[model samples]
Target: MDREAKKEAFRKYLESSGVLDALTKVLVSLYEESDKPSAAVEFIKQKLGGPSLSEHEKLQAEKMDLQRKYDELLAAHRDACKELEELRNLKHEGDVKEMVDNNDAKEM
Candidate 1:
């Protein structure tokens, strides 16, 4: 109901969910590192089993590549459908021409 009460409830939730313990362990590991990482936040995130910056970047690149490929494939599919429709129309026209020619020949 109050600000302090909300903070206490959230803190209890974190402790009960083991988030506080996990963070403590990760922090301890970072503190004990012989050579501290220049990117301390990234180091802590990685220690906490989150993706490091480079890995995140690599995944982003991969997703972009896949999206590009999907767009290309979609364009190709649309083109193929258009071509197929044109071919069907041509065949229909040819069939109609043949029928008309046959009727003219019968009249002659």
Candidate 2:
């Protein structure tokens, strides 16, 4: 679409989303400030609770948490596998010793 059409669509969106109202209020407050800010950008940022982390930052934090959990689970799985192997070896050794003892008894 043309630039005017895009602008109208964006304006409608901002109004519908209440962003226009919020921004207007913030701007009005800034205009009434006694100690006006040097930078409008900083004033807006401060008005809007300072700079906030975007969704990407939040997702990265969640990803790191999941990664940590996955690492822990993997380590637990390795330990369980090692324990299972040791148990199997012990059982095998016991079976072999029992078989040798039975053979000696039969010969006697």
| Whole-model alpha-carbon lDDT for candidate 2 | 0.90
lDDT of 1: 0.97
User: Per-residue lDDT tens digits of candidate 2, residues 16-55?
Assistant: 9999998999999999999987888877876777653464
- Model 1 superposed RMSD (Cα): 2.0
CA shift of 86, model 1, Å: 0.2
TM-score of 1: 0.80
TM-score of 2: 0.52
lDDT of 1 by residue, 1-108 (tens): 999999999999999999999999999999999999999999998988899889999999999999999999999999999999999999999999999999999999
Best by TM-score: 1
Candidate number with greatest lDDT? 1
Q: Judge candidate 2 at residue 19 and give its lDDT.
A: 92
